[model samples]
Target chain A: MATALNKPDRTLDQRGLLCPLPVINTNKAIQELKPGQILEVLATDPGSKPDFDAWSKSRGHKILSVSQEQGPPKVFRFFIQRSG
Target chain B: MVLATEQLQEAAKQGFKKKLVIVVSKGTIDMLYPAFVLATTAPAMGIEVDLYFTFWGLRVLTKKGVKSAKIGAVGNPGIPMPNLMGVLPGMTAMTTKMMKKRIEKYWPSVPDMIKMIKESGGRIHACSPTMGFMGVDEKDLIPEVDDIVGASTFLGWASDPEAITLFI
Candidate 1:
């Protein structure tokens, strides 16, 4: 439950991208990480949270955690673990 | 009686099938977008994708068409632009340019979406009969086209029992 303990192998900054870009980029980024490695994605797209949730379910990937960073520009962060 | 885990696994494996086929028949900016969006997303979920472009849909693969793809503003009331302005010369062109710029703010450009689809492993097919009807040659098509095939060939790809076909 506490994914904060696990350091991400890589981080993807997807701010300013919108609708489907975040999902598309996140999918590609996960490919570079080894299976079981963590990928932290920071996206400003409002759709990113639901999109990642659906993607993780369909791909069998694990979503370790999802958190929000309220900013002058708000950001949605997802911690995902690549599935084999 | 509870079945063995191995038996359950075998049954689950037998039920698994993951293939998607989309047939696009219109080339307008609005019409082409659903196909583009879906094609790019499906492959990311490990589903194999085949997109068949036919008739006017083939225009989406052309340089001029893709560069100037426009919304049909006259008859349709969906666009907020005044119907009187729709008939004016250059109005459609002006509206399309403005719309395209606005779209870029929220979505990837059409060319980038096509590139993403290819890089994600989705197949793009242009209808061969349409090419002949329009007098367009292979050289006229963009580099992303995987093949030019007739209806029969596309039917063959869509006929697989495991494939889910959608007409867009």
Candidate 2:
């Protein structure tokens, strides 16, 4: 199984959950990150795109990029920075 | 000089240790989850938490239509609606009702989340504007509200030099 990201301190693999799960779990992931550091989230939900955007806005984090990969799992990779 | 570096690191860590509090200004059902979940979990991670409910957001703190809170495309970004469904007049209402069922199925009740948040030591606030606009007395509000305050009260919480504030 591909775990998606190999990061220094923060990586969340949320593949099987639906709707709010990806957003909720990502919220938890961001609170642990350092101010300048980034959190990488790998999700399978297409809904993850807007959900993460709303979450990032309300949680005061930055969504640096959301990359869609071509594969069976339909990976949605999010690079988020903890905002001030 | 190694001791100096260690001391500097400690100070930097301390400076970044301020607690964050957030306010939820909207109460559409889909919007409520992000606020309640984040506020409840904040204290679990050792950060102080506060949630101020105002307007429709107050519905979560009141009994009139708490379970009916839902999202639509007028401005809600969270709904996964297709374009055809969005243009219909009753679409938001229909979508909201459908979402209500899903929320009831998938998550805890709003009242329960409020209880959990309080039990977990997070603070809840109701906006005075909403109360005034809706003609709601404190008794009309769910008992979990720590106080009835303006959004400015939460802004004050968020405004500290070291603190972070978010709107959900």
Candidate 3:
């Protein structure tokens, strides 16, 4: 689905954060958003990938996409849809 | 029998819930098993799991220590020994080593579990406090650790209301 329609209602800046931090912060951000709101997560931690996937599945939230910036300070960009 | 659209929607609504976690610290040897076993399995079950090694808990995550881990015995109050075995006097460090060797034969090693945690997308961290306390350089910690962090940093993750925090 084109989650591009919505400007992310929330932004989770998890740069330099690891593992559970990204997941935890993402969860908290989603809690603060309204139904159908979007959350954008920016992280440098490699562990975010699995944590994000697991979180999305268990929560029934939609993951729009994960875009990686390949370089020093590599970035993982998560565009997410908060559903039921 | 074909279900109605409403029934299908209801079934979808009843789907499994999301599992969210902030931190898991295995503070002792006996405490190590449950935390990592769940960590490796929880993601497959759709839970977001992270293992944060701190204090002596880091013992489980470090590769070198696993081979030489001492099992507590003979009135060793600190080690988590079974009640019956606690009174046994001959179980010294050497005996601990032997016991560890026998147990390792039956199960996945720390390295194996750490790999699973990483491949399955879980995260691992070594506590900075413990590292400093033990005068352990970052190089001494398990290679699986993504980084070294203090308690405040760890707390940031657990601050989320939806996150479950555990001290193993």
Candidate 4:
């Protein structure tokens, strides 16, 4: 069920992967989506938020939102829209 | 005139793409990991990346050398062992195995990182002088190498005004 402003066309789970892998994989994953589609990323790396922020800016993509899930492992969630 | 100047500045900012040029000169597992990490990550960020592997770092471009890379325990202040103990037989191997085990749990291997770098359109350049000095022919290099280049060529690539050059 996709919601307005919160729906993602694709989701990438990067748990257990460290710095650079998450960013690298996210770059790869975003390439598969059509322009303006959103990608949901679920990552366990504490560094993902800033990495995604910088990545989205440099690539001209937009990060719709970033939130954290407070689990024992602490997951970071990012909804990013592909640039045209 | 002010409006025209602002437009020019805006255009320049939008048109400039970031570039990263790294010179990797050590072959130790400890040394190579950081180099490969940056090499792979830069391309993912839409930054052009060029890695110039020279001296011992040329080993990483070789099939056998990449697989047999070891962490040097001798004279390494970071390792807990004293210099005398570090020089003991089998110490380097033991240290290498321990380090490899830890690294494998959290990161991709050197060869895998190289593959990812290539897949992301990063350039891997082998130093021609090192290849000749070490008696390593083109056949010894892994398939990912883009070219064998001299210092002048690598320096030319690094000379881009916006390129961030690093020695690792």
Candidate 5:
């Protein structure tokens, strides 16, 4: 139940997309949320880790956490908060 | 003096919003993809992007060119085939088809990328001299082109201290 408290305001699924799409879509998706809202992104692009990190830093967004699942198709989960 | 130094530090912390100016001079499929990719991606990252298409690159902005753009295997060192083999009649077409297939599997088409760039507020500038040289009329260009400008105008934009300029 503790995890339920951290539910993001919006979730963007960028699975199967490649470099730049993940970051580009994230930028578009985040604009739909209010400042301080959290966006949960599910991306399969291995490059998303660094790309998202750099994108968030440049735009003044706060990346709360990131985790990766090791699978045949590895998935990266990022919880980013839109800065006020 | 201390106040001025503190203000300068604050400005640095805030960071300057840089513009991205990409000059695209080639019309091949391989060359155009990277140029459009960066042009689209930079705007998404909150950077203002201006794409200057000149010389052969101006063809890419034409309605006909976007549909007929092909990759040349003959002179491209990246192609695995020998130069002689690459000159075979269908080699360029085959190579172009193969490259498009590989690219489409994980990426958006060039047209779609251009749309994304425009939607994200990126500007596309066509070189006026190239337009005349290539006989590309304004009606021949895709609607996405924001302006038909000259070298001096593009250079002025690229001269911004906070601008990142690239020639592709």
Candidate 6:
């Protein structure tokens, strides 16, 4: 399915979490990935769109793509490529 | 005119100061969230943050108050007229409960936010005069409070040219 399309180096399931939690958890998760490694983040917070955009810009990470997955509870998927 | 030019030259040499100072004067649940939200966000953005809690806002520094902070729906402009049922005796508590449930969906609770601020190295200060007026001792405040200080001391920090100051 979604996993087969993009093979992420790390995937973080942040579903059911809120704003800063998703952002905070994403920060911790991304730190483990090496430079140029792809980190996939699954979050439910509506604020994640702006939060991820700002996070990517501030930390110089490249956002490969952001897609809203259709689910009973819609989820936001962020593909982030860590950049030094 | 010459002084302005020299100050600009010094600023260019030293880099712009990135600091935020916010004074929280109200302790209502609705009132306190903005301060916590901005305080935490600034640190996330690599900006130094200082929070000054005074008057009614001083309650937020207290363990009991922080744990049970209530929203005042009667006078709060954010909540509409139908919600003004808050003027009733038990309404504030009801409103607080409802707000907590809703806020949990998208944001951390007040106490959690405060903890996050402390963990992120944001400075929290209790107003000395207000503490004295309320007869609250240092032991009553949360462990996160860095200091109990007077207005002058906090004003000195906020007065920095590079500091963005807000009164919430």
Candidate 5: residue B67 lDDT (0-100): 75
**Higher-TM-score candidate of 1 and 5:** 5
* DockQ ranking of the models: 4, 5, 1, 6, 2, 3
What are the C-alpha RMSDs, in order, of all predicted structures? 4.8, 9.5, 15.0, 4.5, 4.5, 5.8
In model 1, how large is the Cα lDDT of residue B72?
Answer: 69
Query: Candidate 4, which segments miss by more than 4 Å at Cα?
Result: B1-13
Score residue B80 of candidate 1 by CA lDDT: 79
Docking class of 4: acceptable
Fnat of all models, as shown: 0.47, 0.00, 0.03, 0.56, 0.47, 0.16
The alpha-carbon lDDT assigned to residue A7 of candidate 3 equals 72
lDDT of 5 by residue, B68-91 (tens): 778998879998778789988899
Residue B21 lDDT in candidate 1: 93
Per-residue lDDT tens digits for candidate 4, residues B94-164, read: 99999999998988888888888888889999999999999999999999999999989988988887688
Alpha-carbon shift of residue B144 in model 3 (angstroms): 0.6
Model 5 ranges with Cα > 4 A deviation: A1-6, B1-16
lDDT of 1 by residue, B34-88 (tens): 8888888877766789999888888988877666668766775767778887888
Judged by DockQ, which candidate is best? 4
The candidates, ranked best first by TM-score, are: 5, 4, 1, 6, 2, 3
Name the better of 3 and 4 by lDDT. 4
**Best of the two (3, 5) by DockQ:** 5
Please count the clashing residue pairs in each candidate, in the order shown.
0, 2, 2, 0, 0, 0
Clashing pairs in 2: B29-B69, B29-B70
Docking class of 6: incorrect
Question: Across the candidates, what are chain A's individual TM-scores?
Answer: 0.88, 0.82, 0.88, 0.91, 0.92, 0.89
**Against the true structure, candidate 5 has what lDDT?**
0.85
Q: Which residue ranges in model 2 land beyond 4 Å of their true spot?
A: A1-84, B1-17, B73-90, B101-106
lDDT of 5 by residue, A1-84 (tens): 237327999999999999888898999899999998889999999788878876776677888889999975999999988989
lDDT of 1 at B73: 63
Off by over 4 Å in 1: A1-6, A69-74, B1-17
Q: Which candidate, 1 or 6, would have the higher TM-score against the true structure?
A: 1
lDDT of 4: 0.86
